[model samples]
Target: TGVASGIAQWENNAFPGDRLDQLDVTNGQVFVQKVDGPVQFFAQLGAYSLPDLGSPYIRSGKATGNFYGAFPQWFVKYAPNDSMSVLAGNLPTLIGAEYTFSFENVNVERGLLWNQENAVNRGVQVNYTTGPLALSFSWNDGFFSNRYSWLWGSATYTINPSNIVAFIGGGSVNTETVSSAVTPLYQNNEQIYNVIYTHTSGPWTLVPYIQYTSVPSDPQLGTAQRASTFGAALLATYALDGGYSVAGRVEYISSTGDANAGAPSLIYGPGSNAWSLTITPTYQKGVFFARGELSYVKATSTTPGFAFGPTGTNTSQTRLLVETGILF
Candidate 1:
């Protein structure tokens, strides 16, 4: 799949702000998969220059020069029996509601909570499935870092084909030299709970989801801190005549945590809340599709940099974005 996009944005007030307008190729990739007997191989390589539209609400890493980027997925899977399988390589993390692929999501930009979660895992995994219940376990390099190790487990229950619930938990620990004479091992733990329901009737389809994440303090730090975030999202799409459709999404996320005194953690800072609404109208014909989206985000926080401006200032911020994309 390949995608090209143009974006325009505006913010009420911000510090170290991002570019307000840009055009780039968001995704250009080819996926190849081969299946033979019980063995399967898959790989996705791509070049992207999409705008950073999620974290901090505005700025992100952008591809430089020509079209060049990193491969997001590559893995191999082997099924030993009807109910068991093994996989190894750089694979997508099993913890999030949104996928790494842009086309697989309902909106052009991912939600606030999704941006903070892990994106990929490099290691091995095992899965077992029976009836409507599936269980999986994995050990991998933490997030995008190979210096740390993480272990994850997930259980999914299917209540019929349209309703499902899943629970995923993972954690990692790393030892770092704090100073010239002392080294402390830091522990990071995370857990996610999710529920999803999909219902389709006539030309209308609706999906409602809820997710929660918890993070405890690192014992190695000078100040112990704990953080948690709870979020919910709803997506709805209505199909129209002549291969046209309208889709919309609404999401809310709230986070709470204490500021760390030493090493940085992945948890959100103290007392922050955000909500967004997006509407996309699209046209699809065969392998070609075009979509236009309008989105708005409003956030509030007591922590300075946590919301808009530098620390100890700026209490709230709002952002609006317009994006258009075409994919083949």
Candidate 2:
């Protein structure tokens, strides 16, 4: 589900120099998921409306990424045997699923550090597992820049059910040398890696994860060249007997990328490294559920124009959110 408010201080700061009233309402989303024997599928469609705050003039538009407010995805998986499985269609990024929970996300929005390059690769991934040993690989049509063809493979070892770790990494070589339509970026080749560790004991689950991505810089956008971000989320969830629970998440984010080299500035050099802590209390009974959350984003970098847009540029921001979801 999504949340909206009458007073939004994030978009375009001072209301983009246009507003018809002192009040507004936001829209949420709806989705459904199911598992039929060996096949599983899920999808969601969300719609939202708010101040179309004018573009705040910045050297680089790193502050926002086309703020087009729609989140939709669907994927289908098939299992023909115990050691083999296949997935086809548009699936969520693997790194995203391993890092954060869908519910209890402090802000309605996700960060910009790397999602900009998280191509919604549409294709297939294969996996095989055998008594503590596993191998997985995938082939996808490049969705990030429309140039790179990403074929990935990985090997895994599972110590135990609750205590497990996977060291996954992949590489994308440029299959098409088309000039970047959005900028002058000619992504020649890139390497990506994910280190995910998950442990679940009784009522608590912990995941200490990291992702490293390297993409080329488009000189036309004043590209901050070769940028990367280091971040972690410590999530603690407590489940109740019935259908109620509370989760707390503390996240720290920092960027190690150039923000001053990209073309015209849409290239998104790293935003100011920041840390945010959020907690969400939720309750659900039957077809109804509600969650109340609060978040605090603290800017650690003094970059002049890099800000989440609370009031001005390059400052801290705090957001309060409440979301309710239902199924029929």
Candidate 3:
């Protein structure tokens, strides 16, 4: 279990318009796991107070308090052999450099790429590992839906003890029909791809990753339009003596095509581009930790600049966050 508290400030009026400068209890979680022979079980239940900074649809409706919300994860795994395993339940998506847990991330807020991608799914996955190569395949509910079906796969290669690379890809299709008509009302398909690389040396670690996704247009709009998004991020961390460390991250994202589509994209609307830089300093001693970060974000649109508020006026913003927590 863990408890974290922090303060955040935004230069311009951002999404969290109500509270621009207020104390927040970012995360409180409980993790339980059991392993016996070839069977394994794990569960994570927590309440998160941080606002959904990037994607509004993710965990947006789960907030019950000013800065408190609940999110849960559970899964079971069975291994029949040393090289193969099967898992079923709610599992974290395996496509991004950052994890769902706050403590596992180098920075306090997720990057543009991480927010655009899917977070978790309920389904079954099979994995196989041999030598320096690992492969996995999964079938799950589409995107964040609980009904539709989607399929995804991943392949990873361990180049050496300190270097590794992975490729993850997935796709899903949805269709609707009316009466006995020969044509369907709408047919939609979505695809996503990601590449991640990690390298570690001594006290320094680096991760560089890229992602692309295509979203289908909505049928209610009565138009066959589509939008696509591309993004990349680089993260680095270095550790110093006496439980001190520093980290930095840089990211870029672009959205093109139909601007009115209901698909998920980066910060701004379609035909928009954004870039950000973040720096963080951290200290850790025993089970206690503290971190401070400063970030700058700038966005440009095809027209009307960037809209961070009720009016499409602001084009850039800066944020500062400081947090401290304990892990026990």
- The model with the greater TM-score, 1 or 3, is 3
Strongest candidate by TM-score: 3
Q: Compute each candidate's TM-score over C-alphas.
A: 0.79, 0.68, 0.85
Q: What shift in Å separates residue 31 of candidate 2 from its native position after superposition?
A: 6.5
Clashing residue pairs found in predicted model 3: 49-67
TM-score quality measure for candidate 2? 0.68
Each candidate's clash count: 0, 15, 1
Q: Given candidate 1, what's the lDDT at residue 275?
A: 76
Instruction: Give the higher-lDDT candidate: 2 or 3.
Output: 3
* lDDT (tens digit, per residue) of candidate 2 on 1-328: 3322222223223213332223223344466667666888766555433211122221112212332224434678898778898887665444442311133242333443234234455667898999998888877644434343777766667898887777766656543443432222322244567676778888776766666655555444334475545556565667777787777666665556544544122222254456656666778787666666665656665355545443336355555555565534
Q: After superposition, which runs of candidate 1 have C-alpha atoms over 4 Å from their true positions?
A: 1-17, 49-69, 173-189, 219-223, 259-268, 309-328
